[model samples]
Target: MTDHVDVLIIGAGLSGIGAAAHLTRELPRTSYVVLEAREVSGGTWDLFRYPGVRSDSDMFTMGYRFRPWRHEEALGSGERILEYLRDTAREYDVERRIRYSHRVIRVSWDSDTSLWTVEADHHGEAVTYTAGLVWSCRGYYDYERGHEPEFAGAEEFAGEIVHPQHWPDDLDWTGRDVVVIGSGATAVTLVPAMAEDAAHVTMLQRSPSYILSLPRRDPFAVRARRWLPAGLAHRVVRWKSILVTAVFYRLSRRRPETVRRMVRKQNVALLPEGYDVETHFTPRYDPWDQRMCFVPNADLFTSLRSGDAEVVTSTIERFDADGVVLTGGRHLHADVIVTATGLTLSPFGGIELEVDGEKVDPASLMTYRALMLGGVPNFVFTIGYTNASWTLKVGLVCEYLVRLLEHMGRHGYAVVEPRLPEGGMATRPLLDFGAGYVRRALDRLPKQGPRVPWVTSTAYGDDVRLLRRGPVADRHLVFTARAPRAPVAAEAAAGR
Candidate 1:
């Protein structure tokens, strides 16, 4: 038996919900379904239950277009984000479309019908569905597991070890000496939160990451947003945030040294007077080379200044009975070890596609606007901005996708897939700014060069123009429509 739908969306996360909302609203006549691996929505926000899980970016730009964020501060907690997602799902009536505990394991293209056959497990039972279009918004974060470094004697450690992704709910860390590994945003966030409860939290990082501490509230905009209408308030705050971020990104891209100098000055002022800025602040890579860390409430620096937390630049050789042993042969005692290492990104879960039993190597497949998988028509994947707000980029993608679907329906195309006819370059990893997850997936992922739409830039204005200006054209996409063929019986009868 086969279940049929106009569209089958994978993952009920931010991107998935966003896309679904657009489709349902614009194309109300189309039938659609969402398959979620987990039981609940909110994706990353719902999954990660760490101590200080919050948005690194401001909420003014991060939140959805239809919803205006009314939080106390721009940076919000995981619970707050989950609430927003839940509200969005409820408001759109998308909750009913979600099929939980249904993990999609295989997707096969049936060219004759111009549809994708998706197979998944539904409560330990096998089920299959066919749809004219398939969109994956599973997100980059490994839904299965986070990447934890295999350290020698990790299991031998007598102390409690935890990864930020799956933090214990009932952790009692009062007066415990905690050690956090990794220098990403997670490490910075966990340190400040742990400092309040832990006896002393020491951040054991191999290399120093450049951190910019900003106040939680946007002082000027907060007043306006409170008094003015939500629409006006959102526009004001969004523009203000976008302009400031764009300027800084432009400055960093053009004059790297200027931004570097600014970072040095900020670190010097934030840290103790006469302290070595190079020791705890300076990063080896260029500014924005890897993601720049953001600290809300100025908590991270305050923790350091108060001596509640100490940043140690050293490598973990192995885990001893009670603590971590540095590569330099120094052992630091830790009552709890928190590995805030990084994430693991699986592009379509490294799935291998076969067309008519012919293997389709995704590395060779071209990406249309860094979203769609080549050879898949009427499908759009929502991958957001690397530098700016995630929703800002994805919202535009959703809008474009809706318009594309409408156009396809009007044109009576049974199928539409982006074809890279030129095949000028092989697929490479999209972002190579040394973000740990990106670097890890470099060899196995799609390659993107610096080009219009194909290459992602920090400028959202450019993206808006590219997405909304006019219909995008590429030779690679092939459109197929059904046509009636003459009956074979007529020809045979005439010949006889």
Candidate 2:
């Protein structure tokens, strides 16, 4: 069976829900449906059920621009975040518009019809849907599986081995030794959360990552909410957060040494005096190079000082029944081993895209304004900022999409595609981030030109500036009105 809609939104997560809400608010006349592969909304939040699962970025910028995050808490737990997403969807009355358990396998675009045919699998049954525009908010990683390195002797380990992507609810860590692999945000988060309950936790990493302590709740935000109006408060705190983050990012890029020193000082002050901060807290890479990890209210540090958690910087020689064995013959005892290594990228939600009967590779195309792809018509894939709150950039993309759709409606345009400039520009990885996940998938991910309308960045300020530039009318975009087509033979014969 087939169904049709004006716009087909892929993924019912943060981006998809926000996009739908934007359409519902700005372009109320537009018919749209949100296709969620999972059984419900809340993409990342719903998927990750690990202990201490929370956003690394602050919630002020992470929350939707239209809706004010009423709480003063900057970081939110995964469960709370999932609830927020569902609440937002409910508030927008978009709950009914979502079709859950619809896993999109393929999307084909036809220029003649100026529509996208989306094929999905619904509970092992094939379902098809068509739409004028296709929006991919499927996120950047695989939901079913996370990136897990094949540790030698992994199978030999007698204890439970868990990956944060698929955390088992019944698995108990109480009074047990837990060793978390990797020192990324997930590892840092888990170490502190599990330490409070577990007998002890060890963060096993080959190298250290810059982990900072940030307040769980923003005092400024709390003050603003208490003093100002709801809308005004949100705007004030959001902008304040954005500006501070943007400035810090600039400092990190231009004056890496200065930022490095500042971060080192912060770490030194927070950590216990004369503790091995250099080995555990200090990172080899500069700030923002690999995307710094933030721990709420120094929870990780608190656990470290309490001797409940220890950071061991060593290469895994092998995993024994007791725990991980280090290269230097030191064996770490662990009742449970958690692989918080990293994530693997899933470009375009791992969906096959065919344009006009020709298969298109996402890696070959350049990003247009960091959302739309060059040469792809009426397609927008939302990827968030790596250096800061992801929602800051995605929220703008949602608003920009709404503007484009409205502009197209007014101009009677059926399709809009971004065409490369006269002279083809040199391209590099779409994201310049140095994270292991990004570095591993650089060759497979999309490319970005060095110049505007083609370049991509984690710069939310730049997105806002470009968004203010215009509506759908852009020099680089190719907008076409639907061409008249001959009637079918059945209609023609009846008319004659």
Candidate 3:
């Protein structure tokens, strides 16, 4: 049996739940359903169970605009984030609309019918659904596995090896020497958390990444909430956080050297006197080339100064029975090795798309306002800002989609697509991030044009003006109504 709805939302995570809530509030007449591949809600929060897992971005902007985050912490734990998502769903009454364990395999759009047919594996059986529009909020990471580099002689290691993406529960590290490989946010977080229980924790990295410390709880937010109403307080804190993030991003891009020096100075102040901050904290690349890792209250630095953790900057040649061997024949002994390497990026949740029996390659498509693809009709994917909190961009996208749908209904239109002109527009990589996961998937991901509305900007301020307040009936967006067809009986009789 096949089911049908006005809109089919994929992935019941942060984006999906927020999208549904927006629809319920803005387009109350529209019918929608959310399909989640996992057995439960909370997509990223539910998947990652590693120790010290928390949001790299502050919670003020990460939380939904409609729902004020009541918690005191800016960088909330994974468990708290999961609880927030669940509470949001419950508050909006969108939990009942979510169909869990529905892994969408394919989506086909037929122009004649002006509908999308989605096929998925639902609870060990095949299920089909049709909708007028398909909204994908499945995020950009491959949940099946993370990016793990092959280390020679890895099999010879007698100690247990672990990847943060698939961290095993009940695996005790008490009094064990732990070595975490990678200099990204995950490694920084794991180092401090593991050092508390482990005899010693070493962060082994090929190179350094820019790291900064932020307060776990914002005093300004706390004071505001205590003085003013909760709703007003939330708005104030959110905008303040957004402005601070935007200014920092702009400074990093405009004056790289100045920002670099400031970050390095901050790191030096955090570490012990005479410590080799240059070797362990100073990154070769310019600031914002890759996302800087943020630690709460200098936890990692405190641990390092206390002699509970160490940083090793070297290339690993092989993994021996006892530990990892460096290129210069130096060995780092460890009882447990954790590879906090990186993620494997997957666009549109790796679901295949077909339009009118023709396979559509996502890479060949151009991003339209960073929300919709150039040639795809009645479809929108939620991709957030890289420089700031993700929800900032996605929330705007959801609101814009609601306006687009309302406009289409008023105009009696059945399809809307962003059509690229056949002229001279230079194409570039969709994202400007230099992270390993993004770089590895650049060729497979979608392309962006050189100009506005076609390029995906990392600036949240620009996106707000373009996506939230911009006109829906833009010059490039082509809106068309499906031509009416004769009755089935009349056509059959005529053919006979």
- Give one digit per residue, the lDDT tens place, for model 3 in 1-496: 5677778899999899999989888887777888999999999989999999999999999999888888999999999999999999988867888888999999999898888899999888999888788999998889999999999999999998999999999889999999999999999999999999999999999999999999999999999999998888999999999999999988998999999899889888889999998888888899989998899999999999999999999999999999999999999998999999999998898899999999999988899988889889989999887888889988999989998999998998889999998784889999999999999999989999989889988888787888788788888999998535412322111111
Candidate No. with top lDDT: 3
Of candidates 3 and 1, the better by lDDT: 3
Q: To one decimal, what is the Cα RMSD in angstroms of model 3 from the true structure?
A: 4.6
**Model 3 pairs in collision:** none
Please give the distance, in angstroms, between residue 405's alpha carbon in candidate 2 and its true position after superposition.
1.2
Two-way lDDT contest, 1 vs 2, winner: 2
Against the true structure, candidate 2 has what lDDT?
0.87
Q: Candidate 2 at residue 378, lDDT?
A: 90
Task: Kindly report which residue stretches of model 1 are placed more than 4 angstroms away from their true locations once superposed.
Answer: 350-352, 426-428, 473-476, 482-496
Residue pairs whose backbone atoms clash in candidate 1: 377-416, 419-476, 419-477, 427-447, 428-446, 428-447
Per-residue alpha-carbon lDDT of model 1 for 1-496, expressed as tens digits? Answer: 5666777888888888887787767787767788899999988888998989998888888888777788868888888988988888878767778888888887778677677777888899998877777887877668777889899998889889999888999887889999999889999999999999999999988899889988888886778877988789888888888888888877887998999999888888888777767877889988888888889867988998999998899888899899999998988889899999998888775545556557666666556777776666556677777777788887888877777777777787777877654646544566656788888876656656556545655578887787767565455467778423212222111111
Question: What lDDT is reached at residue 324 by model 3?
Answer: 95
From the highest lDDT down, the ranking of the candidates is: 3, 2, 1
Candidate 1, residue 286: lDDT: 85
lDDT for model 1, on a 0 to 1 scale?
0.79
Stretches of candidate 2 above 4 Å error?
Answer: 484-496
